[model samples]
Target: MLWPNATRVLSKMGLLARLAAHCDSNTHFLVRTSSGKVLMKIALGDFDVPAICVRRADLLAALLSALPSEQILLGHEFRHLEQSGERVRIHFADGTSKEHDAVIGADGIRSRVRQTLFGKSDPIYRGYLIWRGVARYEGNAIEPGANSESWGAGKRFGILAIGEGKFTWYATLNTLADHSDSPDGRKSEIQKEFAGWHAPISNLVDATPDEEILKHLAYDNIPLRRWGVGRVTLLGDAAHPCTPNLGQGGCMALEDALVLAKCIVNHNSIQAGLRRYGSLRYSRTRHIQQRSLLMGHIGQWKNPLVVGGRRVVTNLLPARIFEHNLRRVYSYELPGS
Candidate 1:
């Protein structure tokens, strides 16, 4: 279910098999509250999603390595953008400029490319901090390929297997936005905050290498009513940034890449292609963005009574409802070949 078109495209390029060799094909996901009781359990493979997790660096490296050298330009920090008639001029920090028929702003949340078009679309913080890292699995109740997320009072923790015995772990804390500390300091804070949470929570945090831990403030941007103008277009976080609650940031970006390519290939000109791409993508991305925000809000509920109610509701909910929603999410397939 994950990477439907992406798998095909990589397979065509003879890279899917190579990538699959190292990726984590999770078959199920388990959800729990801080009380150590299972709240929800989902069988991912039942929905036909074979592969679930990919190491970010590995995927990016593989894609870049597959591309021809001449097609890539590295280390040129994007400075600004200028549009003159039919061409868009890209200015780099290294004092170089280039013009192209179209520009795709996949530059991320703090995108200079997006800033040129929509001035100061800074991401709004959602009053949470996320500490994430990959740690060696050390005898947790959860098995490999079985993703798990546990919710606590205004906090949450996740475990997803990447490959081998390594698990990608993330913990969220509800706090003032933009507050941060040194890596060592953040690591200490996380350990203290989740000290008494549950079994695997402490085990994972304690096992993580101090240097490998990362801390980031969770933030998301408002979706643009329109994604582009003229020959310039936006993709990924530049167009629709959402909180990580739904784990669809990378998935949505991959979808964007495919649709953008399809639109361009089907259109006669760059402008038409960009417009069509926006038309096809805007609504879906907006829906996901709003849904992700809502999910984050719900997941971060601080009141114990509310959290208990959530657990009750989750327990009482029919499995079919979960299946239907997941089916809708995984049902997205690229239009035509």
Candidate 2:
């Protein structure tokens, strides 16, 4: 999910137009009960920039297409690194090494670069597993540009239209970590879990092929006190990994790339630039991480009384109050923009 802030960043990078062609511009967001009753609705069109939903592969292809092929080296697994004065040398598993002015670790959640900089600490599991799939679903329930998430006891499901009659759906359930399903049983398991939730949910699952369904146990790391040391710095999930509750994990990475580049170009030295980048980003990213965790906890509530209260609170929430919080997130501008 590309929120307004991330879309604005993509526009600055000159990739928004290309991606917009194949993505769906979501105009509204709805929070509903498992029985399909709406508890809250927010008009996403009120924001200055539109929120979009695209297939992950499509978004990745757009990013890679904008870069020169030769500059992108694939199959070079990072092992460790050494920093000497102004130069940082990165060693790969293939026994090859390269020296650069600095190193930026965008290698994702289990980043080797991050481990080498800071001590190794495993990501904490959040006691939930998520199943995601995309299907060519056409129905009145899946209105164009409309996104919805339904909450049930200890479970939640989300649906997003990704243009061209394709919908991306995800279901999360409270479960133990490190659980796996048989290769052919994934689709059946998900269908059983979300059975009789709402219209089009079962339909979506049934429409998706068994091989297309993917399962993952949710995990996130505690926000690091510092994102970098010397000539090495981290970006995206490597710096501050968060749950997908708010759909900002990837968006934060996009914002980081832009800020890091600008900070480097504006500073006199690489160290100073990285320091400034961390300082500028720390507070905002930490706040997001905490909030996402809290949301996940609340969404996973299983008690009958607590779930009732949650629904009431959401239904009674003033539109302005909710809009105010969303505006703070979506209206963010790059420093000096």
**Which candidate's TM-score is highest?**
2
For every model shown, what is its TM-score relative to the native structure? 0.93, 0.96
Instruction: Output the lDDT of residue 256, model 1.
Output: 85
**Tens digits of per-residue lDDT for model 2 on 1-337?**
8899898898988888888886777877889999999888877646656788887888899889989999898999999999998899999999999999999999988988899999898999998988999998877887666799999989999998888888889999998886778555888888788888888899999998988888888788999889999999999999999999989999999999899999999999999999899988888889889989998999999999999999999999976676677788888888841
| Local distance difference test, candidate 1 | 0.79
Any runs in candidate 1 off by more than 4 Å, and if so which?
A: 1-14, 45-49, 182-184
Instruction: Give the 10-residue window scoring lowest on summed lDDT in candidate 1.
Output: 1-10
Local accuracy of candidate 1 as per-residue lDDT tens digits, 127-216 = 998899887775857766677789988999988887777778899989997576745576688888888787777778878877788888
lDDT (0-100) at residue 212 of candidate 2? 85
